[model samples]
Target: MNFHLKITWYPKKRKSTISRRMVTFSYQVKVNGCNILVCREAFFSVHGLQNNQGRLKNLQKYLREGRSTSPKDRRGKKGNPSRKISQEAVQTVHNFINNIPKYASHYSRSQKPNKVYFDHDMSISSLYQEHYLKYCEQKNAPQVKVSKCRDIFNQDFNIGFKLPRSDTYHVCDEFQIQIKNDQLTNSEDIIRRLKIERDLLHAKASAGQNMITQLSKLAKENPEEYLTISFDLQQTFPTPRLTSEPAFYKRKLWTYNFGIHDCVSKKGHVIVWSEDEAKCGSDEIGSCLIKFLEIQKSQANILHIISDNYRGQGQNWATVALERSLVRTGKFKAIEHWFPQVGHTRPPCGRDFGRIEKHVKNRNPTVYTTHDWVTVIKELCKNNPITVVKMKQADFIDLTPLEKNIAKKDKHDDGSQFRFSEATAFRFDEGMPSHLKVKYQYTEYEEFRTVNITKKGRAHQKNNPFQLSWKYLKPIPICDKKLKDVMSLMPYIPDVLKGYFNSLSESKEQSDENETDVIDIGYIV
Candidate 1:
């Protein structure tokens, strides 16, 4: 005997109590000569199954299987998928991700299963579109969608797109975890101290920002008397920056941008240079500051500066010496430098840097050299054009020798030795040209721990105090490895920019000190 069966479905309009329009399906089944419209409750009652929408949906799915005879129900059946991702494809993804340049968190490198961060320019969609597709093509592996790639990254990898900031500070996190797990014997004391440290950091940061705001108002009120500014070094801009896939992998020459923003005038000065010209050291920063002060000398007699507590750039001996020299030269009667607590610095220079970053990101023209960056920065803001000081090899002066002549003592006059990194304020006054007044807390300005900056051996001359002279800096040569990388990217760059790439000459002897440092930039616009 031969049997015939058929199944059909159509939309059944239904409305819920919530007054929302909903559409469900009604199914009909025919076996041999009998035909019946499947009723939700009646079907379940007849089959001795639980009456529910899930069962009803499963029934509908089963009937719609398009079988010549009644099809078997697969709702409760579980088994491995018919096809799975190939091992080669998974390995390809892992290899591609592992090869992408990743950096360890500067502060949390010691954390277990170390959390690595990718560049801001990198994203799953971008990787899939710009690089992964071609990578798959080369390996003859099946290309995956962005969703698949994201899933693989989320489930298999231990990485983060953004690095953790002060909110999730590694030290605080470690202490909290230790206390919770009862891992430390003196956990209570440690917790209390940690809280105090965190509170002090926040308080100092708040005080510093308040001081800037006050200085801004004062500068506006008395433009000729007070000049308020914040300066910061932006992330190194890699040259030969192109949208092409090959350029993404190639290492390009570094271009440095030192941004100094005036609080009162709302003007930005970007000191730009290439790695071949000078390194982003303390001396280079001092040179930029000197140039900026020289330009603004006619505007103000006193200066107020705010910056992050970065030892290498702003809070170093060279910077202190440079400020002392400024006072000694009578360029400024008094200079007050404020440093926001580490990890809490949000300087005004960041705003200008953000605009520059946005302009570079949205620019239609390619930025292949430091000159291109200068051109972009010059016209960054139409209302007030940015002052782009394209720093030359001749402009930078070596302040290291002068800094050595300045005293770096262990104790102040009060017999209290403060950590250099812990100091939040530095004041240089013309009255005491050789003395540096230091404050550990930003909230206090009544008194300072005066540290005599005069070298012990050198006598402080009343008339001819510490004099600053220009010691010409030699040209800093690029490393051979970096030059080779730049050469590899030459083919991808435009012909007009080819000369810049060709001119990158490697040094005869590459010193480890000359190698570019991996700066962990945070919260900079």
Candidate 2:
């Protein structure tokens, strides 16, 4: 199978006539009698000759084996080793498992370690210690392993964990973490903080104040003259569970109705349904008010209905206007609507709705059907006692022993009696001028008359002065100065009465102008 070949080279040009002395070289060639091409020029050097012989040997071997010879094997025998878990990672996993009870559900029955199964031949003790024994109680039933727990916690509750996962347990833990880290000083940090700090501050501020101090200073100062009534709605949301279905699983249409109670009058009214589609329509608001007035008739005269600024709830300007219109039209009688200033409705008045919500939460009902839910709510409302205490000056007066001693040392002034005086008046006459000169005659006694009088020098012409009686007037015991000042700024009156008076004045002015226009047109014609 061995092949060897050789060749000699000679110059083509023989200028010296070397025909008789030819430079010829030859070598033994063995190729198994196979024809093969070999270059003669390649055998000039030992390196080239050796290379040619090696190539021939390789070709013969390739023919014998029927495949080409491969290049030298250059691949190394081993691969890169696996990365090892750090000590920090192991500690994190250990701590996570130790704190497992903190995150475990209150209803969870078992407190066992989690187990895991692997395809490879891992050490049984190591697998049991790391996962199986911790989660599984017996050999057959595999409890959720630490790795699986971590995955469940993360996937279900969006909590990140290292190891020893109990998904339910970790949810509360994650919430605690978020709450603890929420001390954001900047505006961006506020978005992360769940607990409101201002409410806590307010609670701390009002904790130890007396009853009188808590009431507005104005009411405390002049209790006899100004009557303070704190009005609120009750049972705003009567039934906590509208249906037997759980809150998270309930259908979208299931809604809860709130029962409104007034704290001052101990009256319970139901705001059963709100038209979610249409915002506070006039008819709905009027109906609610009319019902409230009808239910609580005895306290109707001195009543001041205070409520929040809910668009549909009867507290806005439109509601106020509608109440006045109804009164003027003689539909609603005796009741007056009074709205609290923008921020004054707090504590038991404006935020009474919040108390109702808390009570509803405390009385959680599992309602299976609509009728059952209604019956439950009706019973709850009927049994619930709403006690309204009439607040008086003495009731709020928290005169401590020290305060009593201090007051005893001071002299009490009883020179003046506190009384609210009428500050303004309105008169309407169709024939009266727009800017008529109003003159008041101060007499010892009050009287009303219509007089026709002649001017100082013009006896031929007569002018008629219409007199009006001021019934709501009280004698000013203090000073005419104080009286004048008080009168200048018209005292606060019921909105309904004010609207009625204004409407009367407008009608009178319109009629007077029409009369004057008619006289002018007749003269012109």
Model 1 root mean square deviation, Cα atoms = 13.4
Q: What tens digits encode model 2's per-residue C-alpha lDDT throughout 1-525? A: 656554333445677775754443344444687634444444324235554566545544454454645345434523643343344444444444444433322211123223221223333345446654544443333344456545444453322222233123333345445554536435445634434543332232233112213333434455432222343333322212333323334222122233445544334444443111111233334444444444554322222333433444444333433333333333333223333222221323424344445555777655422333444445444455332221111111111211111111111123222111110111112232111111122121332121111113422211111111221121112122322332222223234334532443353445455553211100000
lDDT for position 494 in model 2: 33
lDDT score of model 2? 0.34
lDDT of candidate model 1 versus the reference: 0.72
**Which predicted model would earn the best lDDT?**
1
- Regions of candidate 1 where Cα sits further than 4 Å from its true position: 1-193, 457-474, 506-525
Model 2: per-residue Cα lDDT at residue 126: 55
- Write model 1 residue lDDT over 1-525, tens digit each, in one string: 222223355444455445332334554445556666766565555555674557556555665564444456665365765456666777889999987855445334334336777766677888889999999889888766688789999999987776454224355455445544555556678767766775665455567666777778999999989889999898888776777787777767778899999998888888988877777778888888888876766557888998877876899998897788778878789999988655444577888887888887787557788898888788787987888899888778777665776888778978888578888789988899788898877565458879887888766443322334444444455556666777877667778867655555423243335555322222222
**lDDT of every predicted structure (CA atoms):** 0.72, 0.34
